[model samples]
Target: MDIDKIRNSAGSMKIADLKEGDQITGMVTVGEDLYMIANNSVHQIKLADSIDPKRIDPTVPNLQQKIFGKGSDSILVSRTMIFAHEICKGDVFEDSFNKEKIMNISIDLLRCVIDMDECFNIIKLYNKDAMSSVDDRRSVDLSMKLPSLGEKAINGETFFRKLSMSYLLILRTFWAAHNKEVDKIFDRTLDFVSKNYRDDERFIKFIQQLVEFSRMFKDWRNLIEHPKRGEYFKIIDYTYAGNNKISRPMFEVVSKKYPQEPVDLEVNMEKLIDLTISNYESLLCFLCERKLKEIAGYTFKVMEIPLKMRRYPHVRYGIALPTTKGPAPLG
Candidate 1:
């Protein structure tokens, strides 16, 4: 019997083929009364004296027991056996393992990126050391003191201008971290602006606005990292500057431009924490993808050491299981 044919036919044999008296060379089906021959033949196999006795010493652990044992040695040995069995069965273990590892890494990277982005945003809105901080604080403070809608409107415009700067900074930082060709892109953008719109006041104004926004975002990030004592309160005040000026059109414009509403100091702080977590998750996804790509290129290196080398059954089985179990059942 050809070994390859027997291996391929192991799963498709009949119970009659596995009875006592038949000669077989392939794997025995556990709990199934079936026997497969090396040449893909089905036959009943007798229990001959030549067959090794299925003896078990109480002290000597079985494969399952050894794999789940307290000692690492036993566990490792069991894992190796399982892995070898899986390979013999034609399982694509290496590819599957690498795919999972890469996914995890990419998720982590994305989370980090998002965290950094939100951190920069929060700092820009509140921190005094951020670019446009002086103008933002002045506008907010002035708006708070005014009773008329018109005065508040004027203040809101200034505040919105400041908020736009924060958005610019966020975009800049995100590009810096993720875009390898950002420098070239920036150079091209500047050249395009100079050649086509340099003489246009609106175009120049747009460029200036974008620059300020980016600067504000970056400055805010710096202040958060190196904060001084009254800094937090000051930042909060600036963020909620037009809270009471809801009737003013300028305030509406600011709200539209930077939709982040500051809650009570404590509540707003919690929101920041939530934003941080959200950002972290986003960055993790990016990182996980990046890592997966890297892993894909080094698949052989990552899975080079065969599971058999470690001799651990649990390791092999665990690797076969899904990384995360599905959601729990509802009551």
Candidate 2:
């Protein structure tokens, strides 16, 4: 594989190869174990300890030359959690922290809502075609297999799962931004909320709710991302006309706060989706509002999501430059 060529040309790509017999071999030798694609999709082959370290980064510092850094696993990252539209308000701006991190998270929360809406639209087909009439001759309540809708449902699940996971990631990012710490997300988030936003009990509860939701779904998010065999159960709704069985992956989530009833998620995807969306929107709105208020002496403007405007609606903000006449818009 031309790794540098692929990295320079494309971010990622999907490969569609033959079904039965396809072999992939490479002459590139390395020191570490290599995991490569082969013919079988169900099984995998690992060539371990078969390469020389000269093929990899082999810079070794002595024991006394440690410095501050410990170790690093060079991983390929595809996308960031958030990217906010950068805008300058004044010459004095935050040089340390990512200035627009909170707003980027807010935008991602909006994305969560938008993606949930799309997922719901896709899943609606299952309910819509659950009963179909056949040319005025016969009417069947359901079919043994609805390939198209099932496929669409699976795609919808993929979208919902990813977008929801992104929201969870940003939820943790908000904690990192607030608490100035990177580990123990739930604890750090709760500490930040208690120390900073505890003046309003309602707001504190809402923040806590958002944190708890993300923490609960952390493992569930992983399960959805990398699904494994025999890790889930199939749920058959006999109440329906046909034997409609939805093979939902089951995973246990350990919650530090709520430890009462472990509700089965086999039939509660919609409810979980709704909860995630609600928590995301609520928490992001609160954070965005706080961020707006944090700005000083900069009478800027921002268009909130529930915005009603004519064509080309935008958030216009500016920093007034010092001028002889008065104050002018800064470049």
Candidate 3:
């Protein structure tokens, strides 16, 4: 059960042969418990309790004094420290917990949203510029040379697609928000998920699948953002047969497991805003209602399940609405 063996093992391991300064490697459990495999000997160690302070004296200078810092029982273990230990022990790769990777993906998603917003703003500005130019013939020449409004509309559509993809990734990643209103909405969504789907393993697995999707989404985003010269714009249709992508699998698994849930998801900006408001209102009702238990229970059902079950598409291959060419395109 060496480090490689531990790394390859699918399940938990237990070994009792580890000694001080003898490096071990494996996945760290949620509670800081390390599961390691060294030379075919699998073991578990509670990291916080296993390390002897005296062992740190020579290897880590001034460690004991630092541990006793100003009334603290022990020095707090930073996430970086934990990750470093995991990597050094060969339990995790350097890229496993890279903040830059996560941030890059997140920023890529955010940029899509920002780009969409900018595209709309640009359209508005172009309209204003056009109107102003009509009154001033001096500037008419400049306006005539500008790109056609059709081009701008095409760019807007392209940006909207990018934004929709990024928004899906954001929902998948479960990123926290800097905006208070967004934070509230996120918290409410989590609460809804917990209340209605806690017992549903399929839903839980759906969330776990998002980690892989986030990576793919980032790759697709990079392709769109920095495409090679002469490369044509093509949407990666996850719904195509034999595609077997994360999003497709997610849809399949959830739809099969929860037949009542909606299969298609529409990205309506206004509806999302409304849903955020509704989430907050429901949360408030749950907290302040007179019949606390009854109200809270019913509110959870109404807020979480009804809309989801009604609007989500049942099949993965159905055409999305509000498409480029109306009903025919949607079909």
Top lDDT prediction, candidate number: 2
lDDT of 3 by residue, 222-301 (tens): 54456545432232212323332122111111121122122211223224323322322222222222111222222211
Give the worst 10-residue stretch by lDDT in candidate 2.
Answer: 69-78
Per-model tally of clashing residue pairs = 46, 4, 14
Off by over 4 Å in 3: 1-105, 134-148, 175-331
Q: After superposition, how far is residue 87 of candidate 2 from its true place, in Å?
A: 10
Each prediction's TM-score against the native? 0.22, 0.44, 0.25
Q: Give stretches of model 2 more than 4 Å off.
A: 1-97, 102-118, 133-153, 156-160, 176-181, 222-278, 292-331
lDDT of each: 0.31, 0.40, 0.33
How do the residues 20-52 of candidate 1 rate in per-residue lDDT, one tens digit apiece?
444333332322222232222323333221132
For model 2, how does the per-residue alpha-carbon lDDT over 53-157 read when each residue is reduced to its tens digit? Answer: 232422321111111110111000001111122222233343433444544453345445445545655555454554341122224643443223434545444
Clashing residue pairs in candidate 2 are: 30-51, 30-52, 31-51, 31-52
Stretches off by above 4 angstroms in model 1 are 1-256, 259-262, 290-331
CA RMSD of all predictions: 23.6, 14.4, 22.6
Ranking by TM-score: 2, 3, 1
